[model samples]
Target: MEFSELLEQAGGAGLFQTLLLLTFILPCFMISFHVLLENFSASVPGHRCWTQLLDNGSVVPANITPEALLTISIPPGPNWEPDQCRRFRQPQWQLVDPNATTSSWNEADTEPCVDGWVYDRSTFTSTIVMKWDLVCSSQGLKPLSQSIFMSGILVGSFIWGLLSHRLGRKPMLSWSCLQTAVAGTGTTFAPTLLIYCGLRFVTAFGIAGIFLSALGLMVEWTTTSRRAVTLTVLACSSSAGQAALGGVAFALRDWQTLQLAVSVPFFAIFLISWWLPESARWLIIKGKPDQALQELRKVARINGHKEAKNLTIEVLMSSMEEEVASAKEPQSGLDLFRVPMLRKRSCPALVTSFSLLISLYGLVFDLQSLGRDIFLLQVLFGAMDILGRATTVLLLSFLGRRTILAGFQVMAGLCILANTLVPPDLQTLRVVLAVLGKGCFGISLTCLTIYRAELFPTTVRLVVLFFLPETRGLPLPDTVQDLESQKSTAAQGNRQEAVAVESTWF
Candidate 1:
């Protein structure tokens, strides 16, 4: 079937199915694309060809045996020829048959089906290509593409946060889910690298927006007691998504096939949107007290409380009188640092946000570059994340947020330092240290999310939380420059001190 027909079929499905699809499937597409982009060169044609060197240390035959392994040893004199040195050849292919007494090994250039094939010796300079390096070496454009995608996420978070607050969460989330799915699917057909990157950025933007809106909506709709658990659950879902990506990518195998498999869920999630009601708190904020009351009544009814017919705006107003009175005037992003009270709250929140971003992004990119064993690290991190989130949810009421956060940070820092010191021989210990670092980081990240949301007042809470990650980018631009400056200053100071000491001795 055609792409348009597939989309039409998905569109025909109800909102609940659509929401379910987006909530679960969209992540698979994002992860699968990331994996494929990193691995695609492995299967490309001409990637496995070998090169043979002639007498003068120059490449001669370009299409040598695919499985030939060449060892080069430089001759003592410049006048040396390829024929002057002895060459040793090894079998390039091996075959295993259950019925055979001994497995037949295909030797050198000889056909596997032919019997008694002899190995052909070649010059040491001849180089047989192994598997092509799957490392993403697209340099300028690829890194730029990745950065643009991340930038879109930053932009989308801000846009969606505002949109959710203004237009209502349900609409924003539903729209974001649909847009992300479309963008993700469109990426597979992108003719140029630039176009592919652009589509990826758009898809990432929509995903960020949808996630932010959904989280906010979930928090606002849940009771105070359930809010923390719900948020933790969401975090677990994200971690689960990451883990699921590994399996999904492995199963799909092919890039296009993986993309399609991942996208299938986005089309399914759209159906679940119908069941998601607008947030009562958000409705009240938007001057829809009647609708808010109706939603609240539904909640109360679900909790086995009779819907009070006499419940009025005044009663709700009386209940929230203290909160309403304490709701401060709106403030701009800059005002966070200007106001003393705001600064106190903002500093910790900013630190938390920065730490969380570094932990998450650092781990993500590290896993992307470090292949094969990446699955093992991801499993470790995912398990830690789930455990950490669950533990945070359990301890949030008992442990002071700042204490827990600080402890986690200290632990994470120590783990990192320890990782740097781990002996090369103690690989197992190194792995343990890495896992410990991830676990500590995961706990800190979960705590920061909850603490940052709680520190800001209701009016500015969402704004502050949404912008926290974006603000982290500002300091990073000058970070290296500032570090170099400090290093230079310190070195100069040390030289002056040394000169003074020498003068005193003289």
Candidate 2:
């Protein structure tokens, strides 16, 4: 019998697996909070030039309304509202007349706001835009900050991807969670935009590590029977976190407070990491049969499997002999490209992953363009994510992973592209398209997550690609051979027919 069969004898999907799943829920939710943090933290609010029209350098006056005072100091914008970036060179008292028309102000001389700008704080009491005066000419910094954070994630992916497999999953996860909590909360004290961007970059770096390490833990810990369901639950939890962020941001109303709120929980995740079980499969592959045996016995004890206590290291070692032999070869991320068969299969997945990320985040970060209440929009997008994942659960029963992945990606792209044809004035239609696009993207993401895990082995799965096999009810492939043999497994039985359809993408 294989190690997977032994795992079942030790009580598959029992108390041990249940506890492991519960441990991951918080980390998954907190990670989602950071993913959408900027939506509230860097939001741009309504604003106009701050021109002192009264004593005390105040725009508001006891004698005149703020709007009436703006008529004298500020110029009319394209929509007849106060110009946000520009103001009259001198007070134009004549424009205060009721007869003022577009022609009257069309030739008015105006200059950029030299002193500073005033913001409307009705929705958000404070944001990074308000803190740094990132308005008008400086407005570009808002997106740049998010871009910087993304670059950190990209850099960290390469670093953590290579290190986690070598060092171990739990340690990397704990360290990354601590790093994210520290850097994330540290953003509140940033005295300058540069410092804030630096802290956010570090925060994103830790986030990438956290995500990769957590994925490794999840894939290695669960049996095939629960893999898809487990992934769906995690995805749904992420959506719940995103939806919860809208409410949290609405209550906090300050960027500093919001940043701290989302970040501080990671500290708890770090503390909880000590209790998580190390992957026995990974231990055995690393030539630590004694440690693997101990971990397995612990699992069996927790799962109430008395027979497992009688098991010896020899039985454990023999069960994983194929995987242990495969691990003798040195491998790295480059191997994914160096191996012709691996390259042929991974390239499509790589392209699909890249395109999906671009489309999904492009839609996610552009929420303000929808012209609806931002809080409402955030919640709506999150709700659609939940709905999409729920839909994927049903579709997976009848559809191949490649078909679902490709189909959803195409549908999501169509929904987002279709939004371009809709007139801006039709706000409801545009929002509908955006929400549908998010839902499709969510389903695509869910499919991609499970599919990628199934395509590689435990050793290199963190870097890129997994075993080239379907993972519906089979054991995890700990080595390349373990994956290749799955092709024959699929052909051997009537129940395995669907596995062949799924693995054909390779």
Candidate 3:
């Protein structure tokens, strides 16, 4: 019997399963927390070049106020304050006194700041930008750090996917959680930008592992009836974490403090993760049915199944062997891409993910530039994200997967186009349209995950989905022809939503 059948026989959806779901969802929430926190923690605030106000590059008279000295010593821009990177070569001391009328300040010849910039620190006292003086010549470092963290996630997905198969899910998850706790919390203490970036990358790998293992365990334990609903709800739960991250960031404006707050939770979660059960199906597939049966009996006892005590390993092994036998021997990882249909779907999915991530993050991380209040806007972002996913789930109940995915994608595209065409002066309109576009992107992505799963359960072995329960049941295809033959019924009892965010946070 399939594990789903076993779960059904043992009482499919009940208190035991509910607790298991909640346990796994904790890691999922933390994963989302890591994804969105990068925005606030790395934010660069308003700044201008710090300069000495004098004919030579020497300090101005002590009587001068910072703003008055800046008026004479910095080159002004038509909008927003003085030039961010440049300052006047010589001081116009008249501007320092309130009684003197400043004249021809725009004509002063300017040079780049010889010293570092003075930051507007009211909102953020410490951030990635300030920590390393990542402005002007070094501005790329901030975004580069973001990309490096993402690269670590992608690398971790492939590496940990293999390790999970070798070391088993539970051990790898525990170790990864330890890695996250240590590396993530250690990031706050990093003395240099290089060290901090490295720690961030390490933290991402741990986040990826928690994401994969927790998701794998939950789906494996549930029956088919609960699996689809479970996946959808699990995804929405991440939005809750994103929302909470905004609140946390709002409360603790210091980047180091925020980093410590988010990072410490992983260590606590690692302690709690001991309560998670190992996947019995994974044990059986790995030719350890005796161990699988032992775990299953524990689950059975939790569900109040008395016969579970009488169940023997040999009986369970015999049942599992039949299903394993019908499937072709597990093919190479290349098999996921070898088939024509799989490649066709896989290519666009990657392109869509890359483009979607760029657009989504670009918009979100630049949110401070928008005229809206940053804190409220972040809260709005979380609310919109939750609403978007919830709307997708609601629509799925009524519309065909393809129709819904196509419709949402098209609408998202249109919203982006509209936002692009809006005139520059209308900041309010721009913010409104930007939020609308982001909301559409959120919904489209949420639907794409559901659509892809329902569309081709056998094709996508994306790293995030590698440990997914749905992948477990797909009888490995021996040839491209085998994939074409099975495509018809491939949708049966399959459901996983865009966990690609775990790595797409690749």
Q: In terms of lDDT, which candidate is strongest? A: 2
Model 2 TM-score, all chains together: 0.92
lDDT of 2 by residue, 260-335 (tens): 9998998998999889877777788889999888888898989998888767888888888888888888888887
Candidates 2 and 3 compared: the better one by TM-score is 2
lDDT tens per residue, model 3, 1-506: 34555555555666678787777677777777677676888888888877655333455576766677668777666684687888877776656566764455555467787887888888888887988889888888988888888888888878776677556778888988999999989999999999998998999988778766765666567664455456666677776677788788889989999998888888878888887777776677667777877787778778877656555777666656654453336644565567566666566666666776677777777776776367677777767777887776566555554566556666767777887888877888888877787777777677655434433322123242221222222333323444454454445533342122121110
RMSD of each: 17.2, 3.8, 5.9
TM-score of each candidate? 0.66, 0.92, 0.84
**lDDT-based ranking:** 2, 3, 1
Between candidates 2 and 3, which one is better according to lDDT?
A: 2
- What is the Cα root-mean-square deviation between model 2 and the actual structure? 3.8
lDDT of 3: 0.68
Clashes of each: 22, 5, 1
Cα-based lDDT for every prediction: 0.51, 0.82, 0.68
Q: Which regions in candidate 2 have their CA more than 4 angstroms from the true location?
A: 54-65, 100-108, 464-474, 490-506
Which ten-residue region of model 2 has the weakest summed lDDT?
Answer: 497-506
